[model samples]
Each structure stands twice: as C-alpha cells, then as structure tokens.
Target: MPRIKPLPDELDPLAAQLVVRLRELKTHGELTMRRLAAGTGYSARSWERYLGGTSLPPRAAVEALARLTGTDPVRLLAMHEIAAASWDIRRAESPGEHEPEEQRRSEDEKGERREQEREQGQPPRRLPHIALTAGVLALTVAFMAALLLVLRLDENVAPAAVATPAGTAATTPPHSYLCRIARTDGRWSAGINNGRDTEISYGDTGTDVAEAQCLLRRAGISPGGIDGMFGPLTLRAVKTFQDRAGLVVDGMLGPRSWKALRG
Candidate 1:
C-alpha cells in the first residue's frame, strides 16, 4: 500500500498572516519555500502548511525564519496576534451551536428513562463508579504529560542568562541584564527601562545585551548591529555613553546604562 499523506490543516486568518509574512520575506530574498525549509530544519511540507496559513508555525519555526531572514520575530508576532484576533471575532459571530438533532433526541430519551425509573418507587440506577474513577485517573495522567511537554519546550526555547564577569559577588547587582525590546519590519525601537512602556515583539531575542544595542542605536549611540551578540563594539559604545552620562564605567549595560540611554 502507498503511504497516505495527511490533509492540510485549514488556515485561519492568523495563520494566513504568518504565511504572508514568510512569503514576503522569501520573495524579497528570492528564496524558495524548499530552501527555507532546509535552512530552518522544518520539513518542506510543514513549511508549505505554515506558509499557506493552514496551521500555526511552531515558535522554533518562527524564530528560525526570522534569524534566516535577518528580521526580528517580535514584529511578526504582532501581526500574528492581529490576525488571530480577527479570526476569533469571526468565529464568535458564526453559528457554533450545531448539535445534531438525533444526538439531542438520544440524550432526551436517556433523561426520560432516568425519570421513569425514579417514578417507579425504585432506587435510581447507580452509574459505574469504577469507570468514572478510571476516567479521572486517565485525565490526570494526560494532564501531567502535557505539563511536562510544556516545561520542556520552555526550557529549550528560553534564553539563558548571559554569563557575568568572574569575581562578581552575589551581593552585587547581576552582571548581565535582560532588556525588553521591540522590532517592526526590521526596524527596532528604543529600549525602555524595567520593561515599562516597552512594546516588545513576541519571541524577540530579549537578552539584555540585545536590548542595550537597540537602545544605544535609537539614542544615536549606534552600538553596531542588533544581532543579539554583545561584542567589543557594544562594550565600547556602552562605556562611552556611561562616561558621558556620569555613570559607572564598568562597560556593562545595566540599569544605569538603560537610564542613560533612555534619557
């Protein structure tokens, strides 16, 4: 027998938006979907589904595309949300209560039978308590499995903290910082201190160093590209900005650096 292929999942508006963005990027770069799939570690068929808006692309897939295209994932996520919201609204307006008439009749018949049994001056039928217990146990096991999967995904996807310099005491403020950053269509915004007033794009490489570079550039500091890789250029720019702002010149972009950048 020939192997059967799975049907494509129906595309919702949000999925459609994701497809559009991915296609736009691919077109501008003159790359094919197969090329993207190969580069991103996603299967070509899966890429087709993702670009066709037939399904939501996994977070990893989104990140891979962003990185490959040298674009930011944050902005892409915002568009996804907008599309999702519109899809949700349309669903709400449509008729979702489509229970089969035969199924309703079957339920009514069962209810009548129960009532009739009660009227006969006899004890009501006892449901199989064991079945209910077994069901609960099965549900609990399934829930636990799902929880574990989510935890694993988080562990894998979450960014690790940047290593602080050695000899930095625990009492001292953490050497590395995490900054909230935003990007839209390859353009990034200035970073805000304490994640406040910061409209971060989803799945952004939200490392503090990356945020610092974005802020630096916005403030005319221009600490090189927003590659999320902190290097000597970034450090030099941070120290220069710190000196001008009369803050500690540790060459680390911290709270003081953030404040100075914002100012």
Candidate 2:
C-alpha cells in the first residue's frame, strides 16, 4: 500500500486526470516504480516524477505503460496530448517565467517560428518514431470538443438574487445550479429558486439546511442526522464531498457544493 499524495486544487485538471489514469494502471499491474521502469524504457525516477504529476511522460512512455498494463492507449494518449498542451500553457503563464527576460525571448522566438512555418505552407516534417503525435493531437482535439460541449446544467437556474430590504425573510433556494455535469439523474431534477439564496452551514437550524442534508444523502454522503443543524458531522461530510468533487474542501455548502450535492 503505497501512500499517494492528495492532488492539490492548483494542479492542472487535464494533467491531473492523466495522473489518475496512470496510477490506476500501475496499481492494476501491481507494479513498483522499478517494475514500471523495467516494463517501459523510462527510468523509475521518471515514473516517480510522472505519477507525482511533477512531469508529463512522453507519448511513447504513455503507450508503453498502457501496453504493460493492458490498458487502452487511444484515450490515454489523447489525454496525454491535452495534458502536455495544458501544462505548457500553465508554465508559460507562471509569474517566474515572465521575470526572466531570456525565457520570454525564447518563448517568443518559438511562437514566431511556428507562425512563420505555418505562413510558408510547409507541412510539418515528421520523424517516423514520433509521427503519431500529429494524429494524437487531432484525436485529442475532437475528444475535447465532445467533452467540453456546453449545455446549461439546469434550464431552470435561479436568477441572480436581488437586494432585499432589511429584516425581510430570505427565500429558500432550489438546488445549486453548478452541478458538474449538464445531465444528472432523475432524482436530482432541476427547478428554479425564485427566492433569495440561503447558504446552508453547520450550527444553522432551518428547513433549508435539512434539505441540504437530504441532498447530501442523495449524493451518497451521510451528514449525521437530518436535523437541519450544521453540526460537526455535517461539516465533515461537506468537506469529504468537496474533496471528492475537487472543490475547495472548505466545508461550506456554497453554490458549487450545492450543485454537486443536488446532482
């Protein structure tokens, strides 16, 4: 049982997803880092870095891992391509990279070269060993287009809350509209909240808090008793749910928490 570090929120989601898949493959194959290295040409140190998400493995390394573990290569390769692009974007955006004038010039030069090559109508010459990268990029783009297709999470989303006069009772909200997917199971149907938004928190006793607890139950998390009180039990459950959902894990049922629980 190797201890795996919890992935922080700062990690790029695309790269994070690939790291998750690689870990699964490694676990299923019952491989140590040394074993993985033996099965692939890459070093065990490289596997450590890749699995830790400090580095993205090369395409061939990804393919080798998939073969050794009997995993499908297409999806992993597509994800790897996306992870690489996204990782590059993150590095380019980092503040430290901007502080170095030399680094900035290098990036600008690379960008200019690419633009010039495109303008010249010169097809990218491919080395046979890495020729598949182009195809992988195309597949990754198509895959992303499908996955990132945007539809409203809930057609009946509540309108933004209006300012209320002092001492007026706030309106109870419908489920959070921030559910991860556009589609949810029928039990978690979406409607509208015509009322003011109410945040459900621990130590709070109200019908809205109770409803939030029930929604948590629907999401397969137990928040102690549904007594409408935000107690420690409810707090723990909220944090657990947030962590699983890659949320802030702050134990507060904000809009995103509300949406995921509602889902």
What Cα-based lDDT does every candidate model obtain? Answer: 0.55, 0.64
**Given candidate 2, what's the lDDT at residue 68?**
57
* Runs of candidate 2 exceeding 4 Å displacement: 95-263
Regions of candidate 1 where Cα sits further than 4 Å from its true position: 1-14, 84-263
On residues 1-263, what C-alpha lDDT tens digit does candidate 2 reach at each position?
A: 87998764567787898899899888765677876887688999888878886667887898778655545455566567667776765564453432432234564776798799899999865434455556556665764674353221232343444344487444333222221222345335212222223676644655666666666666788875555556556677788889999999887888777766655
How accurate locally is residue 74 in candidate 1, as Cα lDDT from 0 to 100?
A: 50
Sequence-dependent TM-score of model 2: 0.39
After aligning candidate 2 to the native by TM-score, how far in Å is the CA of 226 from where it should be? 51
- Cα RMSD to the true fold for all candidates: 18.9, 20.1
lDDT of 1 at 166: 82
Put down candidate 1 lDDT per residue, 1-263, tens digits, no spaces.
22323333434534554566677776654456666776679998887766665456665677667665555455554455445554543343332322333333454775787688789877633335777556655654554454344334342243333333486321111123334556544544444333433332212334555666767766677665566545445666777787888998887655555555655
